[model samples]
Target: MATTNNIDNKRYQGLIISIALFLSLIGALLAFTFYTSSLLERNTALIDQTNQVANSAQAVIKDLFDLESSYGEDISSPHIQRVLTRLEENTALITNSLSAIEQGGVITDNLGNRYQLPNISNDARLDVAEAKEQWNVLEPKIQTYLKDANNIMVSSADELAQAVDQAKTSSLFINESLDKLTRDVFSNAERQATTIRLIQVLGVAAIFAYFLIFVFFFVRRLRETDAEALAARRETQEIMQTVNTGLFLLDKDLKIGQQHSRALNKIVGEENLAGENFTNVLRGRISDKDLNTTKQFIEQLYNPRVKEKLVDSLNPLTKVLLHNTSGTGSDSRFLDFKFSRVYEDKDIARILVNVNDVSDAVYLEQRLEKERSQNDMQIEMLTTILNVKPKVIHEFISNTKAHIEKMNNILKNPGSSQYELEAKLKAIYRDMHSLKGDASALKLHSFTKIASDAEDKLSALQNQGALSGNDFLQLAVHLDDLLSLSNTIEMLGERINQTSAASTKAAHTTPTATAAGVRAAGAIDSTPQANSQVIGSLDFDEGEDIDLDDESDSHLLAYYQDFAQDIASRQGKEVQLNSATLEQVQIPERLKKTVKEISIQLVRNAIVHGIEPPTDRRSAGKPSTGNISLEMQSVGQDFIVSLQDDGQGIDYDSIRQKLVELGRFSLEEAEQLDRNQLLKQLFSSGFSTKDEADEDGGRGVGLDIIKTQVKESNGKLNVNSELGEMTRFVITLPKAS
Candidate 1:
């Protein structure tokens, strides 16, 4: 043991040493990389300095070349020699700086990166040698030549001037040769410097790479350290096995499942959970029926919808399979189960079913349920009695009650299965259908048919049952659509009622005839100009009930003549609201009074809502103030009097939401209704979308008065607003044949 300990300590010591060595190597490489980079930067800066000198040298050469090109040979003449001497001095300074730069390993700027240059040591030496040798050979010869030439030039006068022409050619040739030699020398120096710079760069890159490799290992070490920390979690798992729950594991078939422990003595057979079917162990122990119920429950848990880990509703041991989604037990029973879906190493699902049996608790629950059921029944009976004098919201109340009552039945019938789901859905459809029938019986035609249509749609998918996920989604969407339409219808009715009351007040204030027989002349105009083709049509696959509250057909011309003649004469147009009616449409007293009041009012409204000024009308391609039309027609037992306009149609949704905001209804309620229903509120008393506070559209008694008078005589008011298009209010009254 002592030897082993010694070795282990040595091994750990070695590891620490290795770690230190690794760190040291990294630091050294980093330092080397930095050092090399600094050297290169200094050298590069030196190279740049040398290059600037070279550029200056080239500029001097170019000046010499320019001078040669312009003057035709006489450059060596005393007049030009002074200029040549000045250029040579500048060249000497530039060459010396270049030689110093090529000797460097370090020549850096403030930012330390190596400028690219070659170590031109050997080439620079050769250049210095060549220049020295050339200067030595030429210096004495040039001095001797210059003295002789100067003596001759001074003495010869006109003859010396002639020699100047000859000297220029020789001088230009010499300058050219010198420039070529300088360029060749500089090129060799640049090439040698480039080679040295590249070698240094590669060496630095190798050092940088070594540092990166060391960092990579350091990062890997951190991950290994983190993995070593999970040892405590393994210990916690060990403690969990001793927990005292009557836990047993079940295979797919629930036989002596792969895992069972001493804690499950009562639930299983023998010391070992011998390979036996789970049902056999419970057989004759907790009634075969209950035993089978537990087995079947395991099967269901094995195949769950939306993937689950625990089932709160599990039945007791029984032979007959049972499901307890509605919660089984006598009165107050509590069965909380936690079933973990275990998988083999291959991830196949097995179950560890944990059950907590609390029948006493269940017995208590049943008692409460019975009490609740009794209370609900009592409410239903009272509501039924109240239906005899049903208010306007009778349908609404009944539907809500029906929804609540269906819950108990659904719970009791657990066909906790696909069939039961289909059955429940069928029941729901039937209720909605019955509600529609009831609405129709009450003359709530607007609300009835939409619900019936929705029911029919659901019945088509009943065969698929709740197990069909697609079916459930489809049903939900349909229900949402139906609910939305229902809300619209209800809102429309409330709006009409409000409008009628307001209009009644308006009629009283205006001193309009109260009796049905009052003569209210309507203007009949020329035929409407709109194309008869329908732009958009809503198709339900089954069919849609046509809402016939529109104001188009023959006999519209007469209405225009009745109303517009009074206004057009002022403009000197002599416009006639002409008509061709098959009959002087005699309206019922109930409808007749509403038509008189509204037709007269709308004619005046046209003066405001429809017509532009005479000048404006002329510019707009109209004769004058636009014509207003009132048309009446007969279909079956109803007389339809429609007030039509060629004016800006209202924005019903905005107006509806606004009215709801103003405390008429909530946004949620208003949104459910369609545009037709929203517009119905326009006739409502004291309700208007306008913020301008006008007496016209909002007379504190708009179309609502018209609706009440019609309704008082057993008639109905229908509103149709084709916003920005035109708005027409159709009043229908039963003919007294």
Candidate 2:
């Protein structure tokens, strides 16, 4: 690995160097090209300037010649004056053009931008001065001739001819000097062009040499690296194919390696497992919670601060049971997972995971453990049977069966209307609480465990104050489990009785109570006193009646009132519940369960969320005790149940803000929602004003479940609230079929 890493580092460094060199060469070539192009433009511009100056000089000479030719002709004085004016304009143009060539000034460019041109060479400057001197000497002579020509009557035509001859001679000298200046500019432009071309060629040659050197080195390194990589790949392939255990590598991002063992796919129940996130692959196999924990565990393994051994206990994938989806659901397999860090030069390179299927061994171990537990339980049961009175065992079983019946009745016959959820909750809590206490008194360990679990669920519901119809429905599963165990114990008791009857009948023993007790005590030899203590706890003489099917005659409204009073006393507050007669309203048995669930939830919500304590009421100048009222009646085909409490009403503004906070609506949308729309949010799941979950309120589910039950029964839930006044929920349900 070290050797491979060194080779890789060297190759990477070489690649970087090659790229830098190539970029440098290209940069140099570009700089040279821009410089050469600039030089070429300047040289061309200078040559053109020289030519323009020469043309201007020739224009002056041509005008002088025309003036000289017109002097000899019988031209009028006006025509002579015009010729002289043309001659002077041409002379001035030549002088200005020459001065511009000597001293740089603004010239219009192709883009109509003014750009300054540089001064010409010294030789061109000297030529311009000579031409200017010659023009000065000839200008006065021409003007004097023009004066003579205008006075054709006083002056002879010879003076005009003499002036023209002098002007022509000066023009010739200026033209000769301009011509020499133009040749010098052209010769210099040619030399500069040659130099620019030569520099460009040299630059290209240097770039080519640099590129060739890089290519030769890069190719040699690439070939060497490829050969080494090919050999390593072949070796890795052989190992991957032969390995029995599921082996795979994970990179820094926890992505599976491209070259993983074939067994890895089978273990994880996926094909083409490579390149996929390891967590995602396991998602279908393990629970999301476990998958997250597994990811954390793997991450911890990679943490430099944490020791691998220290995090071994945190490994969530260790001995995880995975259900084989590829087969029948019954096929569950346990996988033993192991992780190791693959290091390159003392740094973590990748993580290696090894999965070994331990399904058979785990299954065997579990079977042995279960058999041992069963053997011990059976022995304990026999000992308890021999020690305790037969009546007590029968009584315990009977009591448990009665409790189970009560639970089923609670589910089947829900008390109160759907709007009085609190009443139903109180009733359910009483039932489950009674069952737990009775089971504990009897010391039925297995029965108590199941019963205790059920009681705990009821307590959770009470604490959360978020009761739903489905919440009660969920209890049926635990009830069934408890009933199943009850039936098992009943069967066991029957078998014990038969065995006792057979032994007694065979011996024909007339056993006295005292002797029977003595024999029972002797069976629990080590704790004879404890055995007597267990039997002595129950009164055998006074037979306890067990009525499994008994239904209470309590009115729903009265029960809620009593329940509210009881809760008020517990809370150290005073509250009164007033209600209209619900007896006349016939609630269908089909809707009873839903109605019961909703009623319990709503009543609890009222006392916990809507009703204020006595002190708060007194401070508000109301009565010391608060009042909660429930009214239910049948109207046409609908049954309407309404409940109200004189307490702090719903905070519409708070609800609106909450809606925005929860992302259910934007701030603008929430603000636009009227009182009616905002009140509907109270029935939304997970919506509540309470900060903490308690038996009375919070847990946000009460109103939600009430609404759901009402809707399921083809009913409608409506809310009305005035801040600092009263809050009411009126539910209207269609009469059940």
- Candidate topping lDDT: 2
Q: Candidate 2 residues 387-419, lDDT tens each?
A: 455544555566567767866876777545554
Q: Residue-wise lDDT of candidate 1 within 1-737, one digit each (tens)?
A: 45656765774574567568667766765676676666555545554555555455455445445444445446567655764564455455444544454354334433675353445546554543444344334333333333443342353233333333333443344344334434544565456457656755765676567557656865676566556546654553454355444466678777656545444443232355546676765555455666667777777766746245344245344112223322332222234446667654435467766644444456666788867854664444333323322232433443534443453354345554676666655555444444443343333433344454554455456423245434444445445544554454445434434444444344434433433223343322111111111111111112223232331222324333533554444333333233234145544544443454445455544444444556665765656545445677677888776766654556767777777877777888887877666656765544545454322232323344455557665877776556544566677777762
Give each prediction's root-mean-square deviation over alpha carbons. 29.9, 15.3
Tell me how far the alpha carbon of residue 569 in candidate 1 is from the true structure, in angstroms, after superposition.
11
For model 1, the run of ten residues with the poorest summed lDDT: 527-536
TM-score of each: 0.22, 0.49
**lDDT of residue 308 for candidate 1:** 51
Go through the candidates in order and give each one's C-alpha lDDT: 0.49, 0.68
Off by over 4 Å in 2: 1-11, 67-93, 100-163, 228-261, 272-439, 452-737
State how far residue 142 of model 2 sits from its true place (Å). 7.6
